[model samples]
Target: MSTPATSRARGVERIIDIFRQLHAARRPMTMRELIVATGAPRSSIYELVAIFSEAGWLETSGDGSVFFGREMHYFGADYAAHNDLISRAHQSILSLVRKHDETAQLCTLEGNKYTVMLSESSSRPFNISSDIGVKVPIPWTATGRLLLGHLNVNEIRALIPDEDFVLENGTRIAFDDFLRDVQYADAQGYCCTEGLSHTFRLCMAAPIRDRSGVAVAALCFMTSRDTDPKKRELMLDDLIKSAKALSEPYSRL
Candidate 1:
């Protein structure tokens, strides 16, 4: 038997599930599509959609495909405004984009995976796409390595699954090498990698530590693998300085 409170909580979970599916799809979806994707009962889907639509939390297209409503944008905007790290990091990342004309990211660890909570893409013809809102395996990113600097070797080994060592390009990273990278990052306070996630992209990352000096997140930028050596060095210097600037807000946090 379920209480009324329990039933209401489940209803909220269903609503969140629908929102997750829509966010992952990144496009309007019809009723049938939502049903197939969510695997929820048809009646529940209909009722939930109707309620959300009426409340301006969802909207339907002319073709009856459903998407997020203006209210969701308003909610998201409010969240961005009040989030301390995001508000501070957003300005720092934009400055990096203007300075180096490269894609800059604010990355944090979500469990064992990495998330680009915020990103500013470059205007160059051969720019890299920052994997914002995508949960990627830790070994797939330089930022992940730097972010793991906060953890001990034992904690890191326990957290990352063995299968996560396999990259999208079919390369297998040795655990010993990954551990060494983490140790190096912890010592140096930064790290850089080339041809990890994509063959033509290079990444540079620095730590954003909390008041206790644990690296809660990373500040990173991506450059072309073919970038000039001298220019890359200059960009790295600018990035390290910008990373420090971003870290200043930690005391308040």
Candidate 2:
């Protein structure tokens, strides 16, 4: 027996699901595709789509494909403008890329996964960049270690799915090794890893702490594995300084 309130909540969840599916697809979807993706009844989905379209939350293309409307962009822009961490991180990464000529990113945990909140790409002929908002396994990134610094071993084990330990190359990372890395990152205030997510890439990350000294986000650089050791060390030092600056309240200015 669902009350009206519960029913309305369920409808809201379904609407969110629709948006998530569309974003994950990274493309416009048709009515039939929306039904299959959201698992909502055809009539209900159609009604919701119509209402959203009228409200400028969604739009239909000439081909009848549905996608986010201009209103969604406005909403996202407003969020970015108001979010202090993201706003500051965006500028920081731009500076980092200009100084180091390497891809720089601001990353954070999204549930059990790691996600790039913002990215600035390098202008070098060969560079690596991650898709913003795409979620990846925690074990697949150097930033993942620093992001999990506040969690105990048991909490980390419980948070990460078992299959996430397997690397893209079919190598499985032992839980003990992952725990060791997390502890080291916590102690050192920074972390670096090579060839975890990509065979030819290296990542260096430093934690952006909150007032409580817990890592709320990570600032990172991704460069080729063949980068000079001295350059890598310099980048890591810069990352640590920048992360420390961003953590302080006055740094937001």
Candidate 3:
């Protein structure tokens, strides 16, 4: 038995799941598909969909498929405009994109995962396609490893689940090894990992620390694995500079 408040809360949570599934699919979803994806009752799903559709948060296609409405873009744009970090980071990321001709991203930890907050794609023929807002296992990302720099060995251990190390590509990094990466990033103030997530590219990340010196986010750069060692080192240096630029303003906030 659930109260009205709990029922409303459940619906809100379910709505988020609906959007997540839709985004993951990168296309519209039918009501039946949403019901299966969300594991929600059919009636509740229908009602929620109707509410969102009417409010312009969602839109239905002619074939009865639902997708993000134009209004959702408005909300996202409005949010980006207001968030100081996103605005500031976007400028820094674009500079990297222009200079290095490689993808630049700002990522943050979310639970046991990391989500790309913003990205500027490279103008080169090949680029890393990191979809913004997609959450991936923390252990699978170089940024994820370094983002844990703020936490201690025990806290990091508690925060990351054992299963996360078994990447989608079937590689299982030992906990001790992963812990060492965190410790190294913490001590060295930056990190670069190649082929841990995407086999074709390398990622370099540095902490964007807050006033309290806690890392709230990461600024990262992606480059081809074929890059010469000297150029890779230079790109990594630029990434560290960009991260510092973003972190400095936040240090006052």
Candidate 4:
């Protein structure tokens, strides 16, 4: 009962799944492993893998495992080159880290979760850093509050899943408290949280607004929880300034 359009769409979905599986694995996968991971028919997976390999989207190893090819790297490099926001954000985080000697990250909402799009780690031996592209519960991050500041109460409630309210340590955040934090963050133009995601870490975040003044991304720093209060304020002030600079119109850059 599948129409040609539906069939082609399914094929596209399968191709995307193949890449997703490989990325999640972080290594080469054998043909059978790919079939199992994607849940596609063996024959279909074989055909698609063959086509992708020939097109340089995938490459095979001597042991018969397959992984992403050089073409994928080229595509990623091209995207970074052309994306003004990403390119600029990268520079901003690098500068922030160099100045403060702390971990700095560029973050944004991915679906209902917060994700670190780019990160610059501190040179110190002991520092906090998040894995890029890892999806984290929105309620567990200071940037999450800032990112959702533009949303209405009803919209924010509906967007985040109920289970996401629970923290890693089995603590449940009150909805009313979370809403108040979001509003405060919007009004103050910055936010800070201690021991929300990690027991001994402090997070500070500032919004990077688009032309309409809605937060489309965030600039954040993660430091030790025991950092002096005066130091925290200084870093937060610089972070807010940096974020505002990045939020300016692209033509201004």
Q: Name the best candidate (by TM-score).
A: 2
Clashing residue pairs for model 1? none
Stretches of model 2 off by over 4 angstroms after superposition: 250-253
Candidate 1 lowest-lDDT run of ten: 244-253
CA lDDT scores, all candidates in order: 0.86, 0.92, 0.86, 0.91
Candidate closer to the true structure by lDDT (higher is better), 3 or 4:
4
* Model 2: lowest-lDDT 10 consecutive positions: 244-253
How much is 68 displaced in model 4, in angstroms? 2.3
Name the weakest run of 10 consecutive residues (lDDT summed) in model 3: 244-253
Per model, how many backbone clashes are there?
A: 0, 0, 0, 0
Q: Where does model 4 exceed 4 Å of error?
A: 251-253
lDDT of 3: 0.86
**Pairs of residues at least 3 apart in sequence or in different chains that clash in candidate 2:** none
Q: Which regions in candidate 3 have their CA more than 4 angstroms from the true location?
A: 251-253
- Residue range 15-97, candidate 4, lDDT tens digits: 99999899878889999899999999999899998999999999999988999998998998888777888899999999999
Candidate 1 per-residue C-alpha lDDT over 1-253 given as tens digits, one digit per residue, 9 for 90 to 100? 9999998998888899899899878889999989898888899899999999999999998899999999999998887778888888899889889888889888888888888888899898778866577788999889888877767778889999998999988999999999999889889888999999899989999888777787888888888899899988887887778777777655332
Clashing pairs in 4: none
